[model samples]
Target: MTSITKRKTFLILTSLVSAIAILLLSLKPDTAIMDDQTLYEKLNNGNTIYYLVVGDSIGRGAGAESRRDSWYAQLERLIKKRYGADMQGQHISQSGATAFEGLYKLKNTELIYPADIIFLVFGENDRKYMEPEEFAKHYELLVREAKVRAPKAEIITFIESPLAVQEFANQIQAVSSHYGATAIDMRKAYRQSGAEVKSLNRDQVHPNGKGYELYAKTILQTLDEFPNRKAPSTKEALYVQEDAPLHVTTSIETQQGFLYKEPYWTTGKKGSSIRYKVQGNTIGAIIKRNPNGGMVDVFIDRRYYRTINTNWPLVKERYIIIAAGIESGSHQIEFITNDHGHRFNGLDEKPFQLAGVISATINSKGTAE
Candidate 1:
């Protein structure tokens, strides 16, 4: 009698446990369906105007407490009210994605096809790690993919913040221009309106609701200004600035990274170096070729890595090298000039200027740009 009773109790407990497991499994959120359902619903709706946003934290509506308070949502509202268009929106963004990471997501993802408009906002997170040239290459890749995935869509890119590194914004604009997409410089628009930078900012990086509203308004205005035409080209040049977050040997100078300015670097001897300590899976730099340019040795952790020959005929900014697919953590990079010589363009013997240095956590391959 005891054995029979015990067996019945054990069977009852197993059934209960299985029931709970099934319930938990049913309750688990389905990520693929949650965001995609709205997209599919709108795609099937004949009266809907679809907009897709690909970006970082700001695109994900970080500072806004509610989804409706986010800038993209607000922008959709304005368009619906003003033009009487039925608006639908989707944002595919993670908190800390750089342009390369965003592109990676796009390559491996599936979204609604043939969107009416696409917004690409990134680079705030990128500037902390990637150099301008690296940023531009990845940005271009993202744009190219957007164009392919949504052929009928007009792509628009927005500047994240005025306080962000200026070169990164310019790089975004340049990428947009290259792809014939629209580029909206929100920072400049905010300044021209005489709004305090902090008034729109929720944190050191993200915008508050009020700020998001302003950003939406600005985008709408910009859209109206050029309803039928592609955005005008920025064609901004790349350069390095003095306040750039880099550590360098005493022989290096900080007078090359500014915009529309002459680049000048003077180091009297060999072993004069430029260094940057960054956290990412990639590292690179933007360098200007000079007539007097020579070989520069690259080292990681004092071990020889590679050598860069900066000698060329043209005076132009170029991405020197990118070491990608590394482990995530702090990394040390040193660029030491091995030989500096006098050139046809200049008489200086010890002068080699770098436009900028970039580092990032992008681990993808075939992203060499």
Candidate 2:
């Protein structure tokens, strides 16, 4: 071949390669919002999705007037419509469980089915239990187990909605981060929906048909926020199952108790005692404790943080408290019960939210609103 011809062919191949690279980059997300664990990388079409849905009645589709309009069904339908509705290998889960209790199920049972993906939903019931630290431990264990079980399965942990619209908004994402999984913030979707979305939600908690429709659509759209993965198709309805629940959780209705009375923190004086309750095997907390301002030694989930001078860093506790590590949710910064004796005895027995979800501009990756 002539030298000129060879040069021209080389240039053409190089240009094609560069164009392909550019296309792939454009398609991929600029940020890693989902599971940071690389397990979610796309695979061949034949690859099966043996999924396991874990959590409360939502997983069981309880609030739904019919089984058809359930969260699980909606999620499944969305998955199927996008992925050709391949249902053979998937495992439908419905354990009347919460977060802490979920640890046992995740570890002891075969529910997590060895598939390419596992959808973990909990925290609602755990909120009732109020053992956020233990729940954090269990969550970490679940992630470890999932990685061990599938090694390749992408773990997606969905944060359950709190009883009030303004609760637990920051928690789920932090916990997800500790486990090295992707944390999809549904609250953003909820917020985006505005009052109309709130109205669609049944009893201020679970979403109704309209609510579910919004939920499914927002979630599906968020899937695009993931990597260069292909979905089943846009033709698939946002979610399957028709009917849905029109009421809030009965347990939440009790309104008889709060999650923490004496939360475990790291800044208790030496020998000071910090107590936290173990609710439903997990702890659902809206921690907004800022230890950077005092000389308190932090005590939480078997860990400690030393605040030198007035600057306090978060001591290792359960899940990640959102709003710059606890500018929101339920929290209280207090001294240990026995600071004089250099021993700690946790907090009082009556639980109440010391603080609530304060609006934060830099909630994710330091992004400000």
Candidate 3:
């Protein structure tokens, strides 16, 4: 062969190898690459490293066969094995919780203040019930609150599922970036793992045991990538105004059809109604859900707003946001039972129960009405 021909063949082969390398690099998980470990070592000192996990059902490890098989539990084990450090944390995530509900939980629940690390695993439920913009607003607020409470904590947000919508993932990435936190897009890791994403899920949403294992592995890999160890600075300009103090009231006005039960007002009669008045822009309800839970219509300022069906497969208590983004002032909220001899899951005569009401107004100076 001629010298020119040999050179041309070598050049072509080099170009092909380069293109393949680029493709593989592009297929890797979306995480920042860092080699420094000073902060990591500092956090791994002999003292216990407190952490917090906050989000939806996925965060609460719903589909795992047992608590030990959950992703968070597996991740804790991995951290202990790898770093030889003691760790402690709390998981305050609730099933069927949206971003708004997440924010409320963060505000109301007693968190581990000054935690060494925090994981946020929301967005799946938000994508189902909330607009992207509204979700973004609440998510940003949640992140900000975490920062304010745990200024020196390493905040990490997870794109929990492969089936998560693109918009919700984008919003999480954007908010994390803006707040100097790390956002791990697990979808990329799942796609690159060569596993069928559908097989990882127990149902349409929650992950099975095998799926949780994959989740833990992905999170461990991301942590190994040395994501930002620096915490958010309290001196930084705030993105949203601080929320007012939350007001919770269990005192409610009920008609004769309703009977007072410990911790809840229960009624099997149709047309039973309860009323609450509060001063706030955002309002929510604390209610019970069971196999026989019935539906209740919500009214704001005397106009029907939405209907809430408090039915679940098991007896579970939930704090749900029923109304938000209303004008900042006094408002009247009502919940009326609509039981009509409906049977759910072989249970007859579904009943309505109320636990309490929660509200947050814009004014910080006045008491709850």
Best by lDDT: 3
Using lDDT as the measure, name the better of candidate 2 and candidate 3: 3
Taking the candidates one at a time, how many backbone clashes does each contain? 8, 33, 0
Predicted structure with the largest TM-score when compared to the true one:
3
Candidate 2 local lDDT, residue 260: 30
Summarize candidate 3's per-residue lDDT along 1-369 as a digit string, tens digits: 999999999999999999999988876642222212234654454345678988888888889999998998888788788777667888878888877777777877777544777889888877765566656667777887787777778888988774458888988888898887888877787787788877787887888887888888887777677643566664332334555566888877545577777788788777888888887777888887877877888898889989998887777778887766677888888888877424565663246778788887532223243
lDDT tens per residue, model 1, 266-326: 4534667766566655566656665677788887756777887676665544443346445
- Each prediction's RMSD over C-alphas, in Å, is 16.1, 18.8, 18.6
What's model 2's TM-score? Answer: 0.46
lDDT of 2: 0.43
Query: Given candidate 2, what's the lDDT at residue 163?
Result: 36
Candidate number with the higher TM-score (2 or 3) = 3
lDDT of 2 by residue, 1-369 (tens): 999999999999999999999988876764332232232232213233456655555555555656667655575577667755443233434333554344434554664354656667766655544334434444444555556556656567776544342334345566556544566556666677675655666664666666565556665565546664422111211111211111111121111113433432233233333333221111222332233222323333334433212221332222222112233222322223222221123522111122211121112222232
Model 1 TM-score is 0.52
User: What's the distance in Å from true for residue 44, model 2?
Assistant: 7.6
Each candidate: what lDDT?
0.65, 0.43, 0.75
Clashes of 2: 33
Clashing residue pairs in candidate 3 are none
**Candidate 1: where is the Cα deviation over 4 Å?**
1-47, 229-369
Q: Is candidate 1 or candidate 3 better by lDDT?
A: 3
